[model samples]
Target: MATIAPSPPAALIDGFGRRISYLRLSVTDRCDLRCRYCMGEAMTFLPRSAVLTLEEMAAIADAFVARGVRRIRLTGGEPLVRRGIGELAARIGRHLATGALDELTLTTNATRLAEHAPALAAAGVRRINVSLDSLDPERFRAITRTGDLGQVLAGIAAARAVGMAVKINMVALKGVNEDEVGAMLRWCVAEGHDLTFIETMPLGVVDEDRTDRYLPLDGVRRDLIERFGLVADAHRTGGPARYLRVPGTATRVGFITPLTENFCDGCNRVRLTASGRLYMCLGHDDRVDLRAAWREGGRDALDAAIDEALALKPRAHGFRIEERDAAPAVARHMSATGG
Candidate 1:
């Protein structure tokens, strides 16, 4: 009898011994809102034909799952803006039910959640991350350029009504909506939603200087500690944010300090752009054109391309805004790469 050989491990481990189990997949680069920090006012959106179809997305996701990626978060300029998103969610959900994927989540601006929340929840999206910078109506409009605060609030309610776990992501910016941090926290606590404060990064072209908008969360974290008696919580959802619980309340606030405090050491995720490019790091521009491989050589060729990209994953991202004038700037925009 011939001896049988063991199969290879089904996980993508980088050079730093980190097992990458999460994938942020961008379904579309088009967005409804034009946030200043995310993109420029006059931007050219990608042609519809350039984007990967829903089937293509599922195929790429399946390949990653075969290689040990169990969790996936659909993101975009705003994922909800993409057509046939409900069907896409259902397709990914089938993978979840089959045990090929563990979780399927989405990060949206919540502009269209009111219309699609029920379908999304029924389709297997159990969790959602909504981006809301300010609760104030005028301030919200100013921040998002064309957003209605009431619409987003209603969308949030719709998402919750559908039994989806909702988390609010606020990109805290100095002189922008930073003053509303305390108010936002209180509102989230009242609504029974967890909140996360994110420091703005220099990923894409913004309306102002990147340094001007950068707001470190150190001060905000200190404020939470002193005012709300905030304490670190021993809860992690396999994401980068650090969770802190408010005493006497079930509400938890998180801080994602990509700038003031780098969490690249614990990085265990990779990104897939809507255009079929695999990004090794968000802060860096290292990418592999998987679409080319798929069209040229099919699944085997794409698997080889993915393996090559995984091997080239950088140990850490060299992100520094202060040194922007000295070093080469990141040319890719956040919209194109997906946040």
Candidate 2:
């Protein structure tokens, strides 16, 4: 017999007064593409039994929504790879219809979005972020290892055709695709999609040293300023990206600088892994095993675990370049953490 803790309060406020309103939920750890920066060449995915069932995910999301979560983003090794994800999206849609959830979004590699986009849009998903590094087929194949540029492009088109607001996320690596910053920006703008340039952070394990691949967005921004005369915009999409707009053009660009710039002060989100672990911070290993707690003690136990985990959310992530080189590497990969 175990003691059942009290129900979690309706308000989820951390020690730093950052009200928790956003949730990034990983549906599955399986992926179709092996992006060099995201995962290693050889990867071991969690068994289906180890991952959360759609019902379990819905229950956990409900718990969070009951607390204070308004926005939920489904992530994964690639969320589209998860079977029957449309069902989960529809389940979350019920919450959205009732005003319990403000937004239901997803981040995917867009490999399978062509098939899943219609189903996802019908299920109430209106916003999507596609991870595309290069527009060139050969370069894209090299970066993703096995991704087809044509398929990804079709997927992006499908998502837009289905009326979902599409955003392109590009992880800029020094010698890999940094040279294509201008081209990527131009292509995204031409396609009427906002593009975000992300600074490669120290997450997961890769064959090459992370420092070798690290490319900050400062140089990219300088080039954009010089080339397009881009200026900072006051618009924020409720994420980490700093938005900028090109003068006389409707195109907007964003920079997510997790290493050079830290946005933890305004951090208002927590992540739930596919294995039912709640992570307080992305850069830290602090997590609560909610699956065990839920199986053993039900909702109260899950709430208790979440309460305990929220208390440990660090003020800031220690993911600086020097610390990345010096500190012990994180054991869990980004796929496992739902990056």
Across residues 1-339, which tens digit of lDDT does each residue of candidate 2 receive? 999997657588888888999999999888988888878889999988999899999999998999989999999979988888999999988998898888999999998999999988997899899999998999999988998999999999999999998889999999999889999888877888888999877777676677878887888888899999899898876788899997876778999998888889999899999999999887899899988988899888988898898899999987765534443246677888886
**Off by more than 4 A, model 1:** 1-10, 323-329
The superposed Cα distance between candidate 2 and the true structure at residue 208, in angstroms, equals 0.7
Looking at model 1, residue 200 earns an lDDT score of: 81
TM-score of each: 0.95, 0.95
Candidate lDDT scores, in order, read: 0.87, 0.88
- Candidate 2: worst 10 consecutive residues by lDDT? 320-329
- Tens-place lDDT digits, model 1, residues 48-120: 8888889898888888888888899999989999989998888878888889888999999999999999989
